[model samples]
Target: MLFRVDPASPVPLGDQIAACVRGAVAEGTAGPGDRLPPARELAGSLGVNMHTVLRGYQKLREEGLIELRRGRGAAVAGGASPGRARLARAARQVAEEGRALGMADEAILGLVRAALAAKGPPPLPGPGDGRP
Candidate 1:
């Protein structure tokens, strides 16, 4: 799998790592039962701290996307079917919400595609949205 990090991005390093792993899983670059490189090794390769890699793995684990074992590192968990279904559900939810807000189908899809292209989670709404 190809992973790249942009030191200048506003997104956290760990999130960038997580996104790369997620992309790999979605694209079939990494298959079920495939063991990822050890966190330390991946950190070294990416020129980031070990904790960053571990954080990424932890996020994947939390999402039920990967299994982490002591000394064994991380491995892809479950079949791709589950992951695909989850993604589909998420996409459907987003589209439904966008339509409910009166956004056109094309606009909704464009936003989805843009978010996917971004490095991490979608940006939070600004002060006008009531966030601190």
Candidate 2:
């Protein structure tokens, strides 16, 4: 897995690390039972402090995406599905807020449909593709 840190971004280093790991897991770049690099090693690679890496790992652990062992370091937890339920709840809350702001459901759903259509197709090669 590739880890990158951008100092110019407003997000904190640890939060950025955590976000990357979460995205990797959701996108299947990091799979269940995969072991993460040690905090110090990853910190060195990213040019950040070890504590920053540790904090990122701790956040993942709190989200049930990783398990920390005493001597073995951090490993990916099996079945670490993204929080879809939480996202749905958040979306509902956002819709409520939008209503309070005088936005219509039709406008919101149209925006969502346009966003989905703009994403194009999935890139993963499937059966019967020309490229070999």
Candidate 3:
């Protein structure tokens, strides 16, 4: 996968790494069973510290997007299916729109929560639901 981090951005290096990985997975450049570069190697290549790369990997692990092991490094964990990606994109759009309208963070989150409550349980998977 092509990884990049903007040292000039206000966002933390770790956060930038994590976001890049997420975007790659969402775009299918990386996918289930694909192993990520080792932390040390990636850090050396990206000109960042190993700790920063590890932190990004840890975040992905916590989010169930990737698995990290002592010797195995990190691997995509099949978490970013196309449907989930679509939902994530839609949520970002909603948040942006809410901000443009001058809504508070809590208000935007509450609006999402209300919509979830209004929708109730999601429909059960049918044929070709993308499960592997």
Candidate 4:
């Protein structure tokens, strides 16, 4: 996966690194069992600290998107699918934002349930002949 970070952005570097992997998985560029570059090496290339890469990897581990093993390094988790990775990342965002807003766990869950019950994002038009 190609990792990138904006040093000036409000988002943390580690989180940006994690986002790269997550996006790769979501877009099917990376998938289950795909081995990732060594954290130390990736850090060198990204010009960030090794621990920053590790922290990103740890976040992926917590999200069940990747696995970390001694000597073997990190690989995409066997259970991770493109859809699952995207959903997991989205869920984490919702939960984090909810917590930041001082929402209780049950309230956050309720919000999710309500959303699930509603019509979702509008479907993209396909083969349209009218609007530009």
Instruction: Give me the candidate number with maximum TM-score.
Output: 4
Q: Can you tell me which runs of candidate 4 are displaced by over 4 Å?
A: 104-132
Q: Candidate 4 on 1-132: residue-level lDDT in tens?
A: 888898999989999999999999999999999999999999999899999999999999999999999999999999989998889888989998999999999999989975764565644435673522
Residue-level lDDT of model 3, residues 53-113, one tens digit each, is 9998887776677888787889988665645544554665797799999999999999988
The whole-model lDDT of each prediction reads: 0.78, 0.78, 0.81, 0.91
Residue by residue across 1-132, what tens digits does model 2's lDDT show? 778789999878997887777777766778778899999999988899999999989977877788899999998788575563244334546666778788899887776665665585855555686642
Root-mean-square deviation of Cα positions for candidate 1 versus the true structure, in angstroms: 12.0
Give the top-scoring candidate (lDDT): 4
Query: TM-score of the candidate numbered 2?
Result: 0.63
Q: What does the lDDT come to for candidate 2?
A: 0.78
| Structural RMSD, model 2 | 12.9
Rank ordering of all candidates by lDDT, starting from the highest:
4, 3, 1, 2
Worst 10 residues of 3 by lDDT: 80-89
TM-score of candidate 3 against the unseen true structure? 0.71
- Cα lDDT tens digits for candidate 1, 35-123: 88898999999999999999988977876778899977789887544466368446646866898899998899889776765655757
Worst 10 residues of 2 by lDDT: 83-92
For candidate 3, list the clashing residue pairs, or say none. none
Candidate 3 achieves a global lDDT of 0.81
Report model 4's TM-score to 2 decimal places: 0.78
Q: Model 2: residues >4 Å from true position, as ranges? A: 82-132
